[model samples]
Target chain A: MPMNPSLLDNPKSDRIRRVADLANAKARRRSGRVLVEGPQSVREAVAHVPDAVSDLYVLSESEGADTEERSPTLAAIVDRAEQCDSIYIHRASEAVMHRISPNAQGIAAVVDMGALTSEESQVAWSDTPTIAAFWQVRDPGNAGAVIRAADAAGCDAVIFVDDCVDRFNPKVVRSTAGSLFHIPVLTMGADEMLAWCSAHGIAVVAADIYGTPGNAPRTLPDMLADRVAVGQSKAVLFGNEARGLPRQLLERVDRIVTIPIYGKAESLNLATSAAVMLFSLAMSSHMGRM
Target chain B: MPMNPSLLDNPKSDRIRRVADLANAKARRRSGRVLVEGPQSVREAVAHVPDAVSDLYVLSESEGADTEERSPTLAAIVDRAEQCDSIYIHRASEAVMHRISPNAQGIAAVVDMGALTSEESQVAWSDTPTIAAFWQVRDPGNAGAVIRAADAAGCDAVIFVDDCVDRFNPKVVRSTAGSLFHIPVLTMGADEMLAWCSAHGIAVVAADIYGTPGNAPRTLPDMLADRVAVGQSKAVLFGNEARGLPRQLLERVDRIVTIPIYGKAESLNLATSAAVMLFSLAMSSHMGRM
Candidate 1:
């Protein structure tokens, strides 16, 4: 049986304060939980990793709408959440819900970060895996967008190398648009990422405009022309937004590729470049020279 | 000879006020001017459309930095502007430059909008021209990014069909990263666009996920497989961010193509979708097959 639909009317209670505090890194660290806001993210969390979710707070219609029950969309999400016997559902007043998350479109969830972290999971390898890795990506929006692109490109996993934004950051999670739950996102140092890819027989392809002096970069179309290279198990690594990849890291990668600019525009931004390069390679590999 | 390096330090002067007012559509319409901000955009204006630029305002170092002269980057831009002969250069206080545009990374310019509009220019048809068109694209950032993507894809032109965001909006211009100067961007009514494309013997390929009831969309890879279709002169029409194309518009197009999603991502955002679709078709067309 589901819990009673008792409304959480207090905006300043200790529980409310703690839930709201999860937005900060320090608070999240102390509690070992992350906040997922909005209907789309919450629905994704409930659908993909219900075991990770501990509580769900939904807005009450009395405080936010004209009807007595929640909006049809939110009601539908609540109905789905109720199927998970592990999830504790509570209806929150408008003030309480706002305090929890300003972006919550009438629903939010508190999930175990430990459940989402890849540290505790076994590293399984497919026969020919395609991975997406980023080095020193700082912006949350860019980070999230790249992750979504990686997911769309059918990458097996996403690795955040070096000093990158936290995947659990609210802005990052929100920008991902439910992709945070779609794929495995791992964080590691540059050396560790290289070692892991090497161990897994995955070639590291650096996506940079100007490669190191000793190793010039090939255009993406040129790279795609090599059917053997396109079929290899590989990890495509992108660089930071501004500084790009360091020389040391560039020299370490097995191959370097560049996307050609056909017009007067200088270059594509990191997110757009990743999408084009990843999707192009994926399409070429799947279609087999068509 | 270049104009004297006069300092326009007053942030509240009427001249400063008028330059800043170009941010608003009403002000730009009245004065026939548009504001260009940042090093990338200002430099592009001076390089590509020097005749349209009337004045350049650069932040004086004392206002925000240590040196009295302009920074090396800004100094180079100023040097480029000096070659134009008609452009009046001014050194502005940080406050004045900030008032002109908060996004200006130390420089801004006032260019004649009449010079940028495509109305006065002749539209010539290329043998197999590729056009990018959008209907009701409301976001400035999305509009700019799409223009940049279209430029990067070697598109012949961009057409804003029906009601859409102004290309000259400061945010849109800044987001283009100088692609605004790279290609001719025109605006027209839906009927006019259809008529123009028909006259030019260009196919209208709608980039949409769903086709009308009678017309099911074909996958992008399937579309790419047809060499004749890939080599044809066409316009790829993207719809609004949320609503997508209306049924009437979708039915009128020659073909409807969709980008296949390989992962759990619900859908790609406007900019990423545009980049992937535009670049894939471009690469395929130029290279024959994968």
Candidate 2:
């Protein structure tokens, strides 16, 4: 799509307000649209999911020049968006861009929400897939951080089990950096997640400090030492931040593994635990092949 | 010390203002005190370093009943503070407590800065100790998260090398979630850090994705495979949030190791990288002992 010649100068315009409204859950659900803010997110959306992006907004130098003096980073993102014939590009003033989203660092994208949601049937699992699943993760930042961790660990997919913060929330999207576009993220009930894993021969390992009575949690090192078991296809389920996994959920999982704390700190936070556990398993699995 | 009989209802009183001023770096320097906010940090200070706490401020239920209906958690922290006869406990109104520090959840403490700073001479190194160090880490939250990660991984101590964020910053203290009191944290120049590691017969390892010319970085798993070398006393030094360690510093390290990115995400953030690397090394070292 060619760039829109007219610059978006009015911050109060209907188009700008509509773009900003996507930040709200109700607005997003009503319009089936989500705002992807910052250069990193916009660039990834354009590169990987170009067809999903309906509009690309870039900060212009002035009312006259739409493509002049942009930071190399922003210019590159805009250029990438131009290659996608489906993406409509618009140059906006600083105030207009700020109004669309305060976090947009010279660029933001309006994407179709339906295009980002992944179903179980759509997922292409590896021969021995590793999945990262979360239960009732409420914080946007924590949710995003874990997704990035999962992606970095090369997890095949992410499943948000039960109640979770909206994955499309701007803060969550911003926190994921660009990993949100790199991996498939699905939202499903806990039972469905467990059943899907079982059907696919993937074991469900719950990440918790305390296991149910009589089922003491295995230390991560102990789990890693079992190379064959660690290398097997699996889904790691993490609990909420304040309240960990419920006993019912723990009883249903195949196993419980906890990160051992060597010092006096009470426990690791959700995000840190997910990263440590996921990366540890990834490293162990990769090393097993060698 | 008995609790102060009178309630501190005035938010603008000199004593309250002085307590609040500890949040400012300049004020902290002049007074030699730091503000430890939230129940976790205050509780940890009282439990681990009681003598360092000069004053403990807690929110009161009302002007009449100083201690009635306080949350069990806050009441427990207050009880711990009371056992230390040197700690002066004061009850403040909700407005006064909020005025002191917005992040303080029912409790805050005024601690002597001198008590928290660990000099090179004072650190008691463990047998084959592991240390976590950062060079020019600028973010307050990142500094605190890394400190917590180091503590959790059983690092002997943490050294903030070169220019870094003030560890006493309330955000840093709060982000540690009480690990600030669990580990010894020191700030020093890069040369001093390197010299101290050399004097102690400890190897220095730099955590960077890209190593200098002619010296490619080793993957973390490969380093982990070398059990004998990894089990030795070593200090793992991380770089700044944006600009990684300079080539000069990277060249001085015994080894440069990078966490492998199995997926397309660019790289892990400072906190996540620290947790993964520190925990991986810790797990490897612990398993080696077994």
RMSD of every candidate to native, in Å, equals 2.4, 1.4
Model 1: what is its DockQ?
0.77
Misplaced by over 4 Å in model 2 are none
Which residue ranges in model 1 land beyond 4 Å of their true spot?
A1-6, A63-70, A120-126, B1-6, B63-69, B120-125
Model-by-model DockQ, in order: 0.77, 0.67
- CA lDDT of B160 in candidate 1? 94
CAPRI grade, predicted model 2:
medium
The number of the candidate with the highest DockQ is 1
Estimate, for each residue in A1-290, the C-alpha lDDT of model 2 and write its tens digit: 77787888999999999999999999999999999999887888888889999999988876566437878898788777778899999989999999998899888999999989876776777778999999999999999999999999999999999999999999999999988999999998988988899889999999988899967899999999987668789999999999999999999998899999988888999999999999999998888721
Residue A227, model 2: Cα distance from true site in angstroms: 2.0
Best by TM-score: 2
Best by lDDT: 2
Q: How far is candidate 1 from the true structure (C-alpha RMSD, Å)?
A: 2.4
Candidate 2 chain B, run of 10 with poorest lDDT = B61-70
lDDT of each: 0.88, 0.90
